[model samples]
Target: MTISSTPEGVSVQPRHIRFDVSDDLKSFWHGNNAFRTAFFNALSLQFPDGEQQFINAVRLYRDRIEDPKLQAEIRGFIGQEALHSREHKSYNEALKARGYDIDAIDERFARHMKWVANLPPSRQLAGTCGAEHYTAVLANAILRHPEWMEGATPAMACLWRWHAIEETEHKSVAFDVYRECVGDERLRRIVFLFVTWNFFKYTFLNTCSLLKTDGKLWSVKTWLGGLNFLWGKPGVIRKCLPDFLAYFRKGFHPWQHDNRRLLEKNLKELEAAPSAH
Candidate 1:
C-alpha cells in the first residue's frame, strides 16, 4: 500500500498484490448466505473480461494523451486492471471447481464485450467510463462500510478489499482518457444512461440465475434478506445515490466526491494486516 510519486507526480502506484483463493473456498463464501455470496460471485464473473475492456478502451487513446501525469496514471491503471483480471479469473475458476456455471457467466460477458467492441471507439470508451464510475462508487461503498464484506472467507475478503483500493486509486484514468480523445459531453452522458440501465439489468439477471441455480431463488427469506442488505438501513445503493446522480452534471469529475479519507484509512488497515492464510 505504499504510495510512490511517479515522474509525472500522480499518486497512482499499481501494487501487484496477490491472494490465495484456495480450492477449499465454498460456493457460498459469504457466511453461507447464498444470495449475498451469489451477488459478489456474479460480480467476479464480470471482472476478468470486463477489466480487459477497460484497459483496451483506455489504451485506444494512449498515444494521444499529452499530459505526462495522466499518461503515467493510464499505465498504472492498465497494470492494476490486468492483475485484477488475472486474480479474478483464478477466483472464478475456484467457483467453477465448486460446480457452479461461472464459466458460462464469464463467457457471456466476453461475448457481450465483443459486440460492444464494434461500436465507435469513443462510444466504447464512454462505456468504459460509465462502468468505471460504477466501480469507483461501489468500491467507495465497500471501503466506507466494513459490513459489506463482514462475513466473507479471508481469501475472498482480501481479494475484494485489494480490488476496491486499486479501483479507487485509478478510477479516473479512463474518464480522463475519454475526455482527452473524445470530449463529447453529450455522448458521454448518453452512453452512461445506456450503460447504467444495461449494467443493472445484466447484474440482476446474472445474480438471479446464480441464486436460482443454487436453489435460493425459491426461498422467500433469502429474497427478503437480500433485499434488506441492498435497500435497508445502511443501504449501499441508497447511500451511493448522490454520487451516482452527480455523474450527470454538465462537468463532473470522480475526485469531486473526494473519498480519499476513506481510501487512506482503509489502505492503512489493509497494509497492517496479513493476506488470507
Candidate 2:
C-alpha cells in the first residue's frame, strides 16, 4: 500500500500507565449504579480480544505500507492497543471475580474473531476501520461531554478517559491504511453497517448478561433508568448519532471531526488527575 498522507500534526504515542482494578473495587463502580456499571463493564470485556484482532488485521498490510509516517503511526497504534488490551483485561478480571461470567463472553468473542480471521484481508481491515470509527466517535463524545461520566468512581473514570484519549489519538490510522491498501469506499460502508449491527448487538447482550448476573436484569427500574440514560437527557449514545453517521459521507475521514483541541484538553486533565496513575 503506497502512502498518501497521514493525519497532519497528530502524534500517536502510547502512555504506559496502570490502574487499581483490584477485587476490592466495587462491582457498581460507575456512579454506584448497576446499569451504568454494566454498560462500561461490557465494553471492558470486549477490548482484550477485540484489540488483538485489530492489531492483527492492521499487521496484515503493515509491510505493504511504504509511507514512513503511516508506518510510525501504525507502530504507535499497536503499542497503544496492546496496553489497552492489558489494562482492560485486568479490569475484566475484576468483573469476573465479582461473579459476572466474563469468561463465557470472552470465549464467545474469541470464537467470533476466529471466524473473522478467515475472511479476506481487505474485509478484515475494512471491519477494523469501521470499529475504529465507532471508538473515535464514542471517545469524542466522552471527552467532549464530561457529564457522560460525571458520577463514575475516580479510578474507573481515569481508566476510561485514558482509553478515550488514545482512541482519539489514533482514530485515523486504520482508516488511512485501509484507504491506501483497499480504497474500496463501497465495501467500507457496507462492512461498516455490518460492524455497527454486531457492535450494538453484542454490547447490549453483554450488558444484559452482566445485569442478570448482578440480579438486576428483571428490575424494571434498571431498564427504565438505563434506557433513559442512553436516550434521554444527557444521552451519551444519542448525542453521538451525528458523528457516527458522518462516516458514511462521500469523502469522510476520521480527522474530519477534528477533535484535537478536545484531545489535548482532556489529555492534560488526565495527566494531572492522580487517579490515572
Candidate 3:
C-alpha cells in the first residue's frame, strides 16, 4: 500500500466491514460465518462504550499526554470507533432482523468496555493497543484463510477486510502513545500478550455464543472450515505475522504499517463489487 501523508496527520480513509453469506445455508459454512459476525458485532457493540472508555482513560491521565500527533491519533481512534459502532449497529440490526438478539450478547460487551474505560490512561492505552494487535492478527488471518472464507459472503470477508485494514493501519499508534506517555515496556508487553490471549478467548466464546443464539454453534463442518482458513492459506500468515513481528523490528509505528496500498487496492475492487466495501 502506497503511503500518503494526510494533512490531518497521516491517516487513511476508513474501511467498512460488510457481512457476506451464501444465498443458501446448504451452500455455505453457516456456523462459521455466523460466528464471525458475532465476533465483529461484539466490537460494534462495544464501540460507543469503548470510546467512552478511551475518553475517560485519556482524561484520567490527560496531563501525561501533550503530543499533538498522539492527541490527533486518539481523536481518530474515537472517530473510527464511532463509525464502527454506527456501521455495526446497522449490521447487528440486520442480524436481529434475521432472528438473533445481538443486544443480548452486546450487554456483556458493554460491561467489558466500561471496565476498560475505567482504567488509567497508561494501562488503558496499553490494553487498547494490545487489543488492536489481536485484531490485526485476526484480520490478516481471515484474509489468509481461504477455505473458511471461500464461498464466504463477499460481504462478510469485506467486513473483516475493512476492519483488518484499519487494524493494520493503526496497529502501532496506541503502543507508541503508551510508550510515550507511560514508558513502561514491561507492563505494555505483559498487557500486549495478555490482551491478545484474552482477545482470542473472549472472541471465540462470543462468536460461539452468538452462533448458538442463531442455532449454528460448533458443528465439525464449521470448526474444520475455520481451521482450513487459518492454516491452509498461502501468503496469508506470511502477510499477517510480518506485521505483528514488524512492531519490534526497529523503528516501527503506525505509519510503518502503510497498508494503505493494500486497503486501497482491495477497496477499489471492493467498492466496485456488489457485496464488498
Best by TM-score: 2
Q: Which ranges of candidate 3 are over 4 A from the true structure? A: 1-10, 13-70, 140-149, 232-260, 274-277
Clashing pairs in 2: none
Instruction: Candidate 3: count the clashes.
Output: 12
Per residue, candidate 1 scores C-alpha lDDT tens digits across 70-174 of 777888899999999998888878777777787677677778889888888899999999999999999999988888888887777777888998998888888
TM-score each candidate.
0.93, 0.97, 0.71
Give per-model CA RMSD.
3.5, 1.5, 5.3
Writing each residue's lDDT as its tens digit, candidate 3 over 96-198 gives 5666666666787777776766666677877776666656665555544444455455566556566655655555555655656676766766666766665
Best by lDDT: 2
Clashing pairs in 1: none
Question: Residue 125: error of model 3 in Å?
Answer: 0.9
Residues 1-277 of candidate 2 have per-residue lDDT tens digits of 4463445666898999998877434557777889988898888888888899999999999998888888999999999999999999888888777777888888887888899899999999999999999998988888988888888888878888999999999998999899988999999999999999989988998998999998999999999999998899778789989989998999899877788788889988999998877
**Position 132, candidate 1: lDDT:** 93
